[model samples]
Target: MKNITFADAQNLKNPIFIDIRSPREYAEDHIEGAINLPLFSDQEREIIGKIYKYEGVSQAKLAGLNFLSPKLPRLVKEILAYKEKGDIVVYCWRGGLRSLVFTEILRLVDIYVYRLEGGYKSYRQEVVRFFETAKTLFPVVLYGMTGVGKTLILKKLAEKGLPVLNLEQLASHRGSVFGHLGLLPQPSQKRFESMLYDVLKELKGFPFLVEGESRKIGKLFLPKELFQRMQEAPVILLELPEEQRIKNLLRDYQVDKIDIKYFLESLQSITVYLGRAKVESLSEDLKKGRFYEFTKTLLREYYDPLYKKSTAYLRNIKKVISGNDIDELVAGISEYWGEFTGRDLK
Candidate 1:
């Protein structure tokens, strides 16, 4: 079997990445685009582990073989479908027996396959090191209160091929107490690191734009290497009138579109800070279809005050753009950054 490092696998043109970990492990995280071709279900893996620990390695091996023998034909059939897609890179948790078996079996049938050396663990290490040592990055941090459309602005910039990092997108969270309001559950910390590493590696020396966020986003923390750079980069304050911000926020949040029970529970979490009387009043506003009033109160009392405390320390205040909506934001960014479209950002 051809043995390759994660670096080699990454550079391989149009490679099919097959993850052969257990379903449970894959559910936690896998290579961003890799296909899950589990070698064992979670229960099977647990049983094998117990047998290996309590019985012996030899007995455990036999049990593993019994489990695999029937699945082999189906596995081969499944893998063969991807034969012409690209070169195959197979990995498990640690390039252990499961992946090795897959590599050998595929090779025996004359399909070119490479086993990832040290597997996902090794790939993860590469990710950690990339951010830890990244010094070539030029960041343009967007500073503004919530609902100022930092994330939306980044999306537009990315569409324009300007380097931009969506930390909120990577974490699959909005970096708030209610960030997960209508979104999927945030990835596990390990999974978040994997996704973060993948995106950062692709950026390579671009003066990317990003939102101003704390060290943590929901359950995930920013890699200190990257966060430190953001802390020092040029800051552009995105200021808009409060009335416009509130209007943008109501549509942006889609608070009424969320699961009512879930939304209420989320608000309940911060009631201690809001006080019981205030919380009850807001709930009544929501139940009575006073979303605008409820949202306006939420912003005035909670989001705005919380955001103002942090803006006092913004570094390298290079410029400020006051605008609302995508077109206006795009024009503001272009006006500020027009001269260096293809060159390195200052």
Candidate 2:
């Protein structure tokens, strides 16, 4: 079994990362592309832990062997399938007995593989270090009121091969009160950072387009250094007519497909700002299927006021592009970026 650092493993050509940890651990976070092939199930790992705590390390080792022995053939077969695709690299929570034993078993079967040194923990440390020290990132932050197509425009710019760091996508939250609506559960904070690191590492030392966001996106917070940089970076404010803004939000949120009970609950969350009476009225409008009116009232009475107040401190406005056409807006942004940086943003 060869030991490899996470950095070296990443450099491997088409490496297939096999996570040899429990399913629960892998579910929380693992190497981004790693597949989970558990050495023991979650309950089995817990059982071994109890043995180690009460019956000593020897008992725990015996228990672990009993749990793993039956699964070896299947696990090896699954890993061998992946090996045909690329070089196999295995990891557990740490470079501990699980990975070591798994790699040894593979060796016995003549299936050589690299074991990740210090496993997931080491990779996580690298992610933390990257966020703390990365200083050369040039962010062209897209600033706009809600429903002005900031995320949509960033996606378009990315399709055109411009570097784009989509924070919302990484966080799995839209950076708003309703950001979690119709989306999967947000990843753990560590998982979010891992995803963010994967994107930022590639865009290091280059200007990347990202939607402007507050420090927190749903339950996840942006890295302190990165958020500070965004606050200080040049901004391009996007605008759309109020009617179009409402339409855009309606389509984006898919109000027709939303659960009414959940929608009402989300509306109540901002009652302190919108007042109980206004929220009740909005909820009624939603229940009545007056989506356009519900959206318009929320924008004018809640979102717009908040957006104006939050952006009041930003004095570094580089340009303001207004339109309902996505393609036109993208072209306008590309033109401004070229003019501002004196380099084509193709």
Candidate 3:
């Protein structure tokens, strides 16, 4: 099998990366855009590993070969399906037996197979390294307390001919415990970076506004470089009155779907601070169609206090813009962005 580097692979508009590892491993992490054409299923790999340890290499090889033999035609068909589109590169956990065997199998069919030199492990290291150094990308930060419509506002700014980098949208997550309330499952970190890079590639070299976020969003962590950049970036705070904020949050949260059980489950994320009885009382209120009371109680008892602490810490770097009335938040965001771009507000 021929070899290729991660840098070269990434530069390809499309490259078929066959990750011949167990599905479990792929689920944990894999190179973005990789297709899992495993040489062994999860359970089979476990059995093979045990056999190799107790009965030695020869016994393990025979068992693996036997398992792969029946699946050979199936594997070839799978590779051809993806291969019909682009150059195919395949690898396993390491530059080890699994991928090598599969590469040879494909080569016999006259397909030029490129094996990743150090395998998925090395690819992961490269991704981590890139993330560590990536913050040099120059990000302008977007900041706001919970439910100020910052996310929706970001979308509006992008629509109005402003350059914006929407990290939260890219991550398929909103950057909070309740962030996943109505969204699809988040992409793996590898996919997140791939999406981030793709977005970054679209903008000219200049300051771009991004929502303020911690290093990790849901199960994915921002690469070290981008995370540090976000932490140090200039912040633009979007503010709204408490009443408007609550109303906007009600729409954002979709109160019609906020059943008591789900509400309690969300509150459970903060059980250490809000005791169980308090949570239960709030839940009871929601069960009786008292959403306003539940939301008010949550804000007074939990969310508002936490937001104050967070805002206090961010005060120096934050540029606060308050009283963004519901009808005006979008236009306000656009005007603010226009000011940054040196354009008269339209």
Global lDDT of each candidate: 0.82, 0.87, 0.76
Better of 1 and 2 by lDDT: 2
- What TM-score would each prediction reach against the true structure? 0.93, 0.95, 0.82
Backbone clashes for every candidate come to 0, 0, 2
Residues 78-114 of candidate 3 have per-residue lDDT tens digits of: 8888888987889898888888888987888887778
Ranking by lDDT: 2, 1, 3
Model 1, runs deviating above 4 Å: 340-346
- Which residue pairs in model 2 clash with each other? none
Total backbone clashes of candidate 3, pairs 3 or more residues apart or in separate chains: 2
Cand. 2 TM to true fold: 0.95
Candidate 2 off by > 4 Å: 341-346
Best by lDDT: 2
lDDT comparing candidate 3 with the true structure: 0.76
**What is candidate 2's lDDT per residue for 39-155, written digit by digit as tens?**
899999999999999999999999999999999989988988998999899999889888998999899989999999998899889988988885766788888888887777888
- Writing each residue's lDDT as its tens digit, candidate 1 over 1-346 gives 7999988887889888899898889978888899998878899999999999999999999998888888988888878887678878899998888888778877888766889999888888887788878677777888887878788888888888777889898888888877877778888887888887677668777677888989999888988888898988888888877777777777767877976666677889888788999999988888888888887898899889888778644657777888766568778887787554455455
